[model samples]
Target: MRPVYAISGGVSKFAKSRPDKNYQALVKEAYDYAIKDLEISFPAFTEIVDGSVASYFSDHFSRQLMAAIMAQDYLGLCPKPSHRVEGGGATGGLCFQEAWKSIASGHMEVAAAYGFETMSHVETWKGNEFIALASDVSFDYPVGGFYSGYYAMMVTRHMKEYGTTVEDMAHVSVKNHINAFHNPYAQKRNRYTIQDVRDAPMVAWPLTRLDICVMSDGAAATILASEEGIEKLEKAGAKIPRPLVKVTGIGRGTDAMRMADRPHVDFETFIKDYATDQEKESQETMKYYQKLWDQGTRYPGVHSFRAGRTAGNMAYRHAGIHDPLDELDFVELHDAYTSSEIQTYEDLGLCRYGEGGPFAASGKAFLPGIDYGLKLPDKPVCPVNPSGGLIACGHPVGATGLMQAVFAIWQLQGSIEKHFNDDTLQVKDAQKGAIHSHAGTGTYVTVSILEKE
Candidate 1:
């Protein structure tokens, strides 16, 4: 276990291209924003964590060894202990976990974590190759080289075992896109329809182009300080809130990294341990889905069900979330694909397993009407991705986790603008939000519950 620390940080807008500058420029932009906006000084960094998806892209985009050193040299904070680590796709969120741990363990007073990626320089196929290399080369290379196909394998298994629908996945996409529309920094503001998704050509059978998160080129950075540092700041007349975004928990686990090599038959089985029922449609939908499973083709594969939920569960338990959907105010999810978000909501205890679609259909998320006195309905519906998730925000690979962290901080700080302008207040006393992110096909899932207090 690691002691918790405060996140006093900022990040850059996730985008498809930083045409005006190179990789270092992009890094500098993120760093400068984090420093200036959050009032952090470069010399305050006692440790650093550098995160990127692939070495090939790191070379092409950043053109530097040890991203921490690159950051330190650029900011002239060298000689402070720094290194780099990569956990397949879990790189960015895990890097934040690492920095938080260092500060919590009394190893460092102040730490800096950065995630940068420029996938535009490289062809799409090459990026796929980089992801493939993360798997067992011998097992994965023999099969077809499609990245989406690998996740599609899980989707097929999920559909077969639980009767999850392509429509359900499409619903996730539509919801995320709608949420992203309000996000000024999101790369894709285009709204999508379920019919549009159904009509679009399938990238993988049962999965369409709309189901996938687009390749993005962006960077994000954060500055973390230990309790001592926080106390020092307060003593120096700098105001800092208590219990501010602490890293209450952290965990790491891995299953079959490759899709084909997985032995699991049912996707939901991955999360059976923490499964719960949705009061609304649990029995009927589960039975209907099972009926579909009995009729459909079964292609059992390794899904992120356990890994993703495990990460969230750890964070939730540590953060003392007795009831997530009600206790949590909002979420910035890892919408790498449409299904990822819906399934993640369930995994995070926001809704019952297999009832995410119906829950989403209820239109409880981000309700249309607003009244300051109008309390949330009987069933609490936490807002998802008010910041536009990876699907719309542009999946800048490693920067996503940091992007989410910054968004969480912003929401907690009351800096976020409501999606719709209402004459009157909507939810009473709204202040906190959650941040959820995953790396590489759900190999790593991180959930942080942030509060204003």
Candidate 2:
């Protein structure tokens, strides 16, 4: 397969209601921003670009189908090969990888990946109800399996199984929101105390409004190309960044939509299958795992995301990441909720299982040079959600993952100060990072490795 590089990326300002722009206009706004960053005219880009992949979570939000074609028309990539991609909240992540495939497979040398969502058309409650339909309607949905309740149940189980506390989860909220406070594109950029998070109105027990991501009307676009494609752009006066962000690896995972249908493996098999040689030999690690198993714990009961683990493992192996905590400089993951952020720390191998709670409070996932006002045990090791993640930036479904990709690219290029106009969220001397996207109650997940080249 050919190597793929992310040439540039852009995002529209994220907000609960972008009343001034329609979905297509939002996409155009992002696309124009990307081209402008590249120092290329949109018309010139139309002539050089090969095709595009449109990403959006649902047609229900727009009340329109084949939304991609409309966006295609708006972007003036008429008659170019194009298609649509969707997978719940992973829509943007999947779209990104799909564009990578297009370039790597020799199908298209230069591909445009864009995602958008106009979720403000419906009332917040109605929008949530529509989102709840992503669950198994035949089983999970009939029982009122909206995301808030489902995520709340999962986090409660996490608390029971791993001693994850509300305080621990609140730290994630505090950290991400503080990180977002510096991000100009983020929706909820206000700084908050841990108590502020806990004091917010409860959506579900122990889960507050401050803990969840808000729906937004926004869009994001990324320009991807092969080696030759990069040269083509350079010849066309595109001021591409040095040490381009390359797509080093990509992985996706899925599980049964119905949580009841999810299966679990026994402890011994689980360890043999999952534990590393070092972990298998560590007496302390073995004892800790054993204690959990002995306490009637199962591998990836609703408390954890098996799909996320699978995706992270695959991407890590593909990228040759042996220790994510030590190797990657940062991670912009789908933090739709604070609890999920902690859960993902374990899933992504930043820490051992059952230690996600402590990881949340450790400051290891925090960006350097930020004053979070919370006492932490460790300095920043691998800063997760440095872009404030979905919890801060707002989740526009399809736009969320692409937004992560854009931020990862920016961080790799050391352009956060230029883009965000605030150097606080920037990771200094960064080399490699990742973007993670998740959908529904762990039904679909995507992880991609991005590195400066």
Candidate 3:
């Protein structure tokens, strides 16, 4: 909300595993990188907000509640106000929001938002159990409902209703993996094919191993400054950074905790009834589900679609963007799964409802050079997940949202030339971009618009 808040610098280190580095080490690394990148001294920041999760999984790790304080100590930022913020997967974005508020409220002149996670220390199933805690314990846990099941249900319903196919989902994986090839910080760099995705072992029916993002270890940091802080630095003979990206807009939303609480039609029953009676019962069934779909779009998310939609709308309004497909140059979506990315296309108003599958298959979401189809627009409608996204870029829970912000800042500042091609997916003189992030089951969602200034 702060008009004067601008991102001066950012850094990220995302990888499949960082066994040698603990949470504190990762945070220190990211903070050091951000300061070096901005060529600014540590004293420039008056406050710090650390976004992190599950650091106390083992006794060897930092205490659960002391991660932020520990990070501050590691970075030699003592005697300064440093607070920790967590919103499940949306932790980093929320941290950025709080830091922005601090600067805007005149509490701090310069602030830093940093996030990290070290999941490699635990086993895969153990990590899944920990993450599952984010969901409603009474309803979700009783029925063995985790993220995979939630997404599978949504994808299954989408398929039955909208005719989204397996190939369509596979295309999403292919596109993002190709994008990951260009990202040095990405965890999964292997180039993949549609067949490769299809052949991968199934995690949930209709969703395969390739469809899901891997648990990762990573950290990301961003430096923010108010107008006064910038002037102070300049007056102090410091080199003012050029082409900073301002936080133009931000939106947040939440929904019912239980998936069943949200409106949804019995897709299987609807299909069966339609086959049995095409005239009377089938028509009523279709209408009923249509109503459900309408409601779902407004409050969608057994997987957080509602939060994204609400947040995106607020952001679009604040940013004065009437048409997302035409106005925004790039998007960093919460692509914890390939299905989520496709679903986001519709939620973000990039395309008509139920057209997400075809949109991905059209190759318009990928860079210009990668050939999923030659019929793709010379430039994509909006380049989604250019930094490889959560799928290949690594989803380190707390760090993911900030990583997305870092990508947007670098892309807007024209500092990411080595990673991506200048001629391919790059929007010419790009001015604006949006970052979307969500917590468990869409309990929390945040969207932010960044503008080149």
Winning model by lDDT: 2
> Which candidate's TM-score is highest?
2
> Cα deviation of 301 in candidate 2 (Å)?
0.7
lDDT against the true structure, per candidate, is: 0.62, 0.91, 0.72
Ranking by lDDT: 2, 3, 1
Clashing pairs in 1: 89-439, 89-440, 90-439
lDDT of 2 by residue, 208-324 (tens): 999999999999999999999988888988899998889999988898898877777788887876664446667998898888888898988888888998899889888888878
TM-score of each: 0.81, 0.98, 0.86
Q: Residue-wise lDDT of candidate 1 within 1-453, one digit each (tens)?
A: 445554555556667677776655666677676665544344333223222121112443444565545655665555556666566556777777777777766777667777767777667777767666665667766666556876787667665555678877776677667666666667887777778877878888877888888887787777677667666554544445444765555545445565555454442552254333332235664565455346642222353355666676777667766667777778777777776676676667676555565655445554344221223333436767766678888877767777777767656655455312321213334455667766655666676766655
Q: In model 3, which range of ten residues has the least summed lDDT?
A: 51-60
How many Å off is the CA of 397 in candidate 2?
Answer: 0.4
Q: Write the per-residue lDDT of candidate 3 for residues 274-314, one digit (tens) a residue.
A: 11122124466456556655554332434336677778777
Decreasing TM-score order of the candidates: 2, 3, 1
Give the per-residue Cα lDDT of candidate 2 at 224: 97
> Where's the lowest-lDDT run of ten residues in candidate 2?
272-281
- What are the clash counts of all predictions, listed in order? 3, 0, 0
Relative to the unseen true structure, what is the C-alpha lDDT of residue 420 in candidate 1, on a scale of 0 to 100? Answer: 24
